[model samples]
Target: MKLKTLVGTFALAALPASMSFAWADAAPEMTDAERAQAKQIYFERCAGCHGVLRKGATGKNLEPHWTKTLQDGNKVEGGTLKLGTNRLERIIAYGTDGGMVNYDDILSEKEINLMARYIQQTPDAPPEFSLKDMRDSWKLIVPKDKRPTRQMNKINLQNVFAVTLRDAGKLALIDGDTHKIWKVLDTGYAVHISRLSASGRYVYTVGRDGLTTIIDMWFEEPTTVASVRLGSDARSVDVSKFKGYEDKYLIGGTYWPPQYSIMDGETLEPIKIVSTRGQTVDGEYHPEPRVASIVASMTKPEWVVNVKETGQILLVDYTDLKNLKTTTIESAKFLHDGGWDGSKRYFMVAANASNKVAAVDTKTGKLAALVDTAKIPHPGRGANFIHPQYGPVWATGHLGDAVVSLISTPSEEAKYAKYKGNNWKVVQELKMPGAGNLFVKTHPKSTHFWADAPMNPEREVAESVYVFDMGDLDKAPVQLNVAKDSGLPETTAVRRAVQPEYNLAGDEVWISLWGGKTDQSAIVIYDDKTLKLKKVITDPAVVTPTGKFNVFNTMHDVY
Candidate 1:
């Protein structure tokens, strides 16, 4: 039976008539008077859809979504509610659009803040499906259309790598085992950051544009979809692995290097905003503005987070999706991008400011380890975040001198290292044959096909794809220049950040490349085992207005 059908079948039998809600994390402490006022405010305005209990009458239960992720790559479910500062601000400024309304003009920001505080202090649960029960329902159904038809290979030293890409405003997916290209499924929103569930059953993504979408791996159609308006633009998003709280979610802020916006995952309700004071030095003054205005200034940058100003990270409980916290770290600098390891034990981000990768222990809420990537490159304004496989991390530096660093766990460390130890050294730094530092990739399935130049477009630097020799880092990563006979001529130019991903079967690597002159985008499939070019699929739908071309910035995630 198909996965979706199986899930539907089980859902029909396993799901109880009603579920009891529970908060997973403790709420941030507040005063009694303030708490009372907050409760009154919540019922006055928010109770229409969200129950007076802040649970939910017409919407989702906020209590069950509060759980978060753990270091073991598992989820910690059930805790008390905490109304983090950011969570309060967002909820007041932007009311939800679909089931909720904009509150910027209706309620004073102060009222919203107090109400959020009260809600956080007060814990409540509504009826819903338990994780175990939900999983059972999914198990008896047919999987989504994107699941692989062929048998998957046993992941080994040669086969693990994460494929990075963008989806249609949705979460991207990478095969959990091989890190190869899995199908890129739409999460229901323009994806800024994509995250997977602890069990790899769901993929989550949100955008600065105030859109959030979640995709169910077991369902053929969308499992659950919701969005919230932050009023101020958003910066980044992180999904917790905590059990019971898998439904919980949170987003970051931005505006002059904006702060993060925290929200409710299950109901798509805005909660609060985390802000960083802008510098007033040099007699220059800066005031925070709406996110939409700030985003209009950039020419082509995708997302921006000023870790220098705000050393804050957002956390949420997956169970109730009600509790949230934004912690600030002092004396920290140059934080780079991050991703969760396979075990879900931890999620590490590049602290480019400190010249080291800071690994945050999800369970203890501590800075567990800092692996130095000293020789690689200096931290800069832009850094790309990629999760090759669940555990191993991949990052590309803009200031780093032509190199890609790969950090692996105990099991895959040796294969990631060029020489002896795979501790904190540059595993591989392939000099960019091009000018910009931007880089993206798809999964590595077969070694059959390679990147090469086209004969038609233009003869610049032999415009082609460079294949790297994973075994050697110091020597130049091998570049495979496709011959004129290989599909499009060797001279055709492709865009930047075009990563190829391997399918679940580990046979094909799918790549979306931009055609320089044709102003068109082409999806190239490389035969992994043979390292040869296979087929090029062109899309006329993606056309740029000015350049008469359509281009894909990053490889969207595989579902």
Candidate 2:
């Protein structure tokens, strides 16, 4: 049977029970406050997959439909369908093979139990957010007229890296040239991704809590000038990169409310809100088709907005916001994160749950190709480089498979017309030591490819990063012990290595040693030439740094 059919059947079987099951009698009950806390936790942690409405897309359906009590008062139990509280708790604690990370290390036992119970109850529909709500919550702390006309500091804006200190609810601005932390500014909880304006003057950060902050780098202190709340939960944010609309507008994608919000780029005054709830490419009406990623087209005055559940890529014309025009291209389901190809004309996004990478030709506004890939391809702005044999290829690391898939992309350049036959094909699959990888990175000037397996539950794999030589694709990756190389004392907890980012010159690569909230986390730097550890940045304030984006690379979409 197809996965979608299986999912539908599973969801239908889990409908809420009219009478309480026998397991509820033995299960520990929660107070009103605890229940509320559990709901919040679910929104922050589980909503991205299971969805705000508990209708599964990338993740399994978590509604109470699976835990309904039978006429005999027994909980639902059948082949591969176990809805008991104990089974639910174990799944939450240990995670499944479907790319869900183990929460045992991230959440407490009590919280896990609460979440297990929370899913058994009927799902709640979050309050809808409108343009008025966004406008009311918008705050312009510093007007554009009051902002500096010229660069106020000597810091090289291109070399500055915006690092997300996830658990700390802060963004650490680090000088990539000097490898030093410049400033740590407060932001929303677990800022998803930091985006740079077209001119590279402003840094925009949207958090999981739906808070978006616009930071002006021209300020002497590099502080946030404007802020607004998109909704309750958001993941992606991007500014207009087209010539006419350079930094004129900003767009944010929210997981909850299933909507996207557009605001003034300078002041963050929300102008419009569009709901993504509609029929998916599969011809099914999905209620929770969250906007996953939005990338501005460099060749056209448009934004490629990827709707996660619907598997529809909407090329939204930003030329006229009042009367917006969109061209929809159907692809695979669960479109998450992606990046531009080497030519920047083709935008490739990972439809992770479907195990496919959908490449769209932004210049033509059409679906370029849909290439099959390994399971759960979670590429955070996937790596792009010229393959030795193939003309150009994009790299994506997988979470459910032990391989890094390199796909050949078509190029319009006249110099390389012979390799056009390999376009939109999986040319190679580099074997990694293990699965569970979130990011794969390569700089234009670097000959090495870096990938981190932080999502892997195994300590050895999670604590290490693999580096592959671009000169030879057949050789195995050199495993670097990132946690041990951090020069910090070993702990029982796994300090996962993640997010390899390059400096402006691509001479050095930085990896984050993500430890527990209370433990000391460090950003370990390595010399790209020698593949040797250079420096380990650890401080009290650098807590749980996950993703570090270089200003020059991010602004230009180098990767």
Candidate 3:
């Protein structure tokens, strides 16, 4: 049992029974450098939704048996929980209608009472990365017949951009027709999503520290030919975009062993790991159900996969990964991130703690609607558009509502058959001047739709970026400060503009000014027909720049 002592014995079996005599009777109210600065602010903002063994998928279970459970059944000698510490510091300074974000404008009240007494202490356990520790952290490094088969780089693999240099574990690869920076590399750690390979000549990425990599933009400088590691946290990755499997299998998912893996799209190897725990689609029993947002179904070689704490979507079937059928379906509950509707046959997603969105269809693999949205929502790949008067909608954006809803998607043409009686319904909400939001984009030859609150904590709506007007969806959007159009220099901390994308000639949009990691970040771009600011892209290796994508709209996932 030495896979680093079996991941430190599964993080000490995720501590519970008197976690060290309740942290030795709450160790003198915090002093070992304030519990090491509250475990580095719970590993940079609460271990990505209450985890690192606090065992809750998409947030909530701060263990110590539910954050110290105490309506007075006596506990709190450091195992603090009768929901106290002023109701978990007012749910970490006002934020939690589930999509949890109001760190009272980014933590302070002494870092939200030191992360509400650091999740009521007792939660360290972080080591189990098995699958022979991801095949002993695999690495190939340039092997598909020593790479470069064709385009040995004149760079413009459909306007290359894949930026996510998040917390500098790196990815950069810029140059969307020379907005510059073209290659940063070294990944895995906050890389979250990049995924291209439907013959965009490989990009892949996927990291919240589960690594993944791949790269090879027909080399001669694009590099990193292969890499692996899909456990110990991860976000999502795709690849096998059907049509005789273009990149031939890749998958990924993970947020800590709630499994997904499936490799070898071009030698990252590990072929199959599955396990998205059990029960949930509300049938209960979910021991961290996660495998959130996977996609890859351009009309089925199958992979829809969602699952966040078991709202169960699955579909899977990679044409027999040694006989693997799948097809689960059930919807709603924390699912997270979505897209594909201007008829890529449905597929929606965001169950964001159940404010619901769910969709599916993928050409009738079923569960096609769920709908009802607003609070939380957070649709990272959402925005489908064609709606001057609601004739094929699909939009999302919310972290606890302020509007942008949209919906309506279902059609058999005939000029959208009078809006098909508002198909999956909700038609229009739009509003937004607030609410946290995480991506909403749009561009099928544009008319403007973009969203992005960068998880709003307000510093002028998280450094602004709204822009509606698909010929006026009842007006009112054009916000745009994008950190004052990224001319950068306004820090009261929130330098977050975040992901807009669109360029394979949608005449520019780009965005990402996400600052911090020695802040200076920039990507801005704009000008999608006079929405203005066309290019700011500051450098010093444009460090913390989150999500950019666009290798021809992420090899045609298009949102």
- Displacement of the residue 357 alpha carbon in candidate 3, Å: 35
**Tens-digit lDDT string for candidate 2 (17-114):** 57444433333356789879988899778887778888786677776655432233344454333455666776777666556667777789988878
TM-scores for every predicted model: 0.47, 0.93, 0.32
lDDT of each: 0.37, 0.87, 0.77
Which 10-residue span in candidate 2 carries the lowest summed lDDT? 1-10
Which parts of model 2 are misplaced by more than 4 Å? 1-29, 67-81
Candidate number that wins on TM-score, 1 or 2: 2
Sort the predicted structures by TM-score, highest score first: 2, 1, 3
RMSD of each: 20.9, 4.3, 23.5
lDDT of 1 by residue, 377-433 (tens): 222111222233322444443222234455543223555343324433345444545
Better of 2 and 3 by lDDT: 2
